[model samples]
Target chain A: MSLSSLPSVSTARSTASLTADAAALPPRAERFGRALLGSLLPLCLLALWALASRQGWIGRDLLPSPGDVLRTTETLVLSGALFHHLAATLARMLAGFLIGAAAASLLGALAGSSVLVHASLDPLIQGLRSVPSIAWVPLFVLWFGIFEASKIALIAVGVFFPIYLNLASALARTDSRWDELAAVCERGRLARFFLIALPASLPAYITGLRSGLGLGWMFVAAAELMGASQGLGFLLTDGEQTGRPETVLTAIVIFALCGRASDRALAALAARLAWR
Target chain B: MAEAVAVRDLVVNFGERAALGPVSFTLAEGSITALVGRSGAGKTTLLRCLAGLLAPSRGEVKMLRGQGRPRIGYVFQDARLLPWLSVAGNVAFGLTHLPRAERREAVAKALAQVGLSGWAHARPGELSGGMAQRVAIARALARAPDLLLLDEPFSALDAFTRRHLQEELRLLLHRVRLTVVFITHDLDEAIALGDRLLVMAGPPGRIVADLPVSDTGGALLKRQVLALLEGSGEEALQSPTLRVLAAHAG
Candidate 1:
């Protein structure tokens, strides 16, 4: 009837509202300054850790100095041990992430589009989602036998739910107005799904991917820690068993770097697609 | 003008409740009609019926072709633009069935028609409310659909922008004769744009009065529409309508 009659206008779309105000980019110098400022806190933290270890405020047995951790990393890299561990973990995470994301998005899209599918699948998914990441470790290890398969499966589990939930909810919550427009446009079901539903769901889907990737890293750590012979997780165990604090610290630093790098890569992709 | 559509005794229900019609009307080809009503008055339901989005529970809406099959262009209350697409891409949305070169030409022409030349590359986020709405209108125009349906397309806009677009719509029509049906709560907007007016009212919505406005904005017509939409819809419905004899709109 009247525009006033509709429950709410969808002009304030969650997807658009986030980026609507971001029309203009900040100056290069300003953006560079912001990035420099972002690094300041971490740099300060590094300085403090180095100071603490040097002054004996924190003993090397407890927390190694930044220099000791960096030297250990250097040794690992030169000896090719770091590459071996990194490649092993990256490969596992990649496989797990691909499997988990593919399955989640496929199901999520179906559930989002149809009530019957959602009703059929959501309860089981929600129930499984509640089961702790660590809890799955024993069950997976038993099934896959304390090997790469079990480790990868655990990572996949971690990656799945965030993606599934985010994607499903996003697609499900898409503004009905677009559906009306599609009806008016006389779009086929396939065109509606791909052209309207998918694009509308992209922001949340990307957000889901980011969260899934983050959880993938966390679950990979847990997976490797539980039963691994060659990973950063294995390095953590090796350092712990050998009483080498520097080696553990090295592994932690590498994990942090890798996680940050992977997240940045996805974030870059998001930026490219975000109202650009 | 040929008859564009004939909606006869159309009724729509949402579960137990009647949402629209049990009313009847016919549309003239290349005519501009406005449906004026309060909230929940079945204006959108009727519009959707014409667009083939809603099926009537009773009665039927028949579209009588004049020449080639009529393509429909709809402008929703909100822009309903795809945020990922550029302004040109959004305009090109319906033109996907056309060849690429034809689609591109239509997009450029539609954008230019809406006075949005050189805005092809701008993202939806970059545009203001008025600009975005203009892009939406351009998107509708790019399809070159002879039957145009707008649902309060300018109501969400500022008064100045709304008035500007209203005038622009009239100007655009001068270049191409098309049948247009728009719904608005604003009596003034209905009178300003419509060649014929369908004033609708109620929870079980029906047309209370169907009136015509002359080229000069209809002041007398506005008062009747306002009264029909005021409180209980029955005031106009129970009374033997003047237009039933004079207009014979149905």
Candidate 2:
């Protein structure tokens, strides 16, 4: 008998159920409306800020007027200072994230595959995990000096732990059934690790990477506050010392936007790579 | 018939508790043996031991092999497809050592055998349970194993899906000519699928009865097997037909 002639009982059932679920979902316009509704509060707050500044209710020295901040932002953009600082911060963030994520994933994979390695290293990792990234900043500066190395080291430390811990746990928690399947297939140890273990642990690994990226941004800012002269964090400190509220607000805004953009990008990449 | 699998005093233990054996059996080549037992009767343990997933606490299992490496295919209760891989990719998983062209051909053949040729690019997540299980079977089939081991492969599906796949699998097995040992708790499924039916009973788990299934006596054999499963050991031993079956099995 031809396979095509056979009735697709389960497939039909699943398809019907999925169709019903899709039907029950809110329409596309309603989803768009909901997203638009979510943005209302933020827009309202921005409007209020502008209104108060226009009414002279907020002192310009203490809190820059929206108009003044906008003017300052335009000046910075035209002068290319904003781009230079933004590029510096972004470069530091990417470099630190790549270094930290690479090392953590490699170490995590090793530890996850071997119980002895995990047992030996887990306590040390767990101990270091509790210390804030800022706490390591002074020590890092002392050791590496207040150059790009210290700042990069600080961000890397901040990025490393989350990826390491999550990836390790993910590897440990990999469904034993997959290993059994690999064994049954007569897959070699290297094949099992690369094909089964690595892919199986990816969802958790991606989660770790995303968290690490967010922390990377935070650590880069903190590191720059100490001895950096070119990054956004430097801009923040410089603004504070000069009592330029506009500059400080600009730095904060840029950081918020960059953080959000990087997170979204990471999420997109993870979604593409994730099994589920 | 040549023996495809032979076992002697196989035993499996977890810590202090014995899970299976002090049991033994020889399965003929190109035969389907259904292992029926109550839940926790160590049927899975026995199958796992045969697959070399778990080491036996005592004794040995030997498969009849000629010169080359032994190939064993295992189908678990779950489909166990790597969620990231496409259907073709999953089927071709065990064929990684083969040349790319051979691997693709093997994957295509396996998928066709399971009637999933059209779904080569689909992800496992998109597949229905029965379809996913079929993919799992195809994955195993791609390896062209000497022996196939299935642990309640159809038990997770709905009755209709299970029944459909059982028929499909029976046909597939006939075409492939592979030796198979499958575990199940359903008496009817055992009767329907197996050339030989082995019953396991116990706290420590041992095979109590092994019957060579003849096509003519299926209903009667099923009833006797059900009785032996439901009744006490003394009653099972007292049944004359069961006695003959057990004697024939030995």
Among these predicted structures, which one has the highest DockQ? 2
Model 2 TM-score (2 dp) = 0.93
lDDT of 2 by residue, B1-250 (tens): 8988899999888999988878988988999999997887789899989998889999999987544667888999999999878889889888866899999999999999998888899878677788899999999989888889999998899897788888888889889988999998777788788889988886577888988888788888888788777855456667776687788766
lDDT of 1: 0.83
> Where does candidate 2 clash, by residue pair?
none
Model 1 misplaced regions, further than 4 Å: A1-24, A28-33, B66-70, B223-234, B237-250
Cα deviation of A177, candidate 1, in Å? 1.3
Q: List model 1 lDDT by residue over A127-221, tens digit each.
A: 98888779988788789898899999889989999999999998899888888877766677898888888888888999999999999999899
The count of backbone overlaps in candidate 1 is 1
TM-score of chain B of 2: 0.95
TM-score of chain A of each: 0.90, 0.90
Interface RMSD of each: 8.2, 3.0
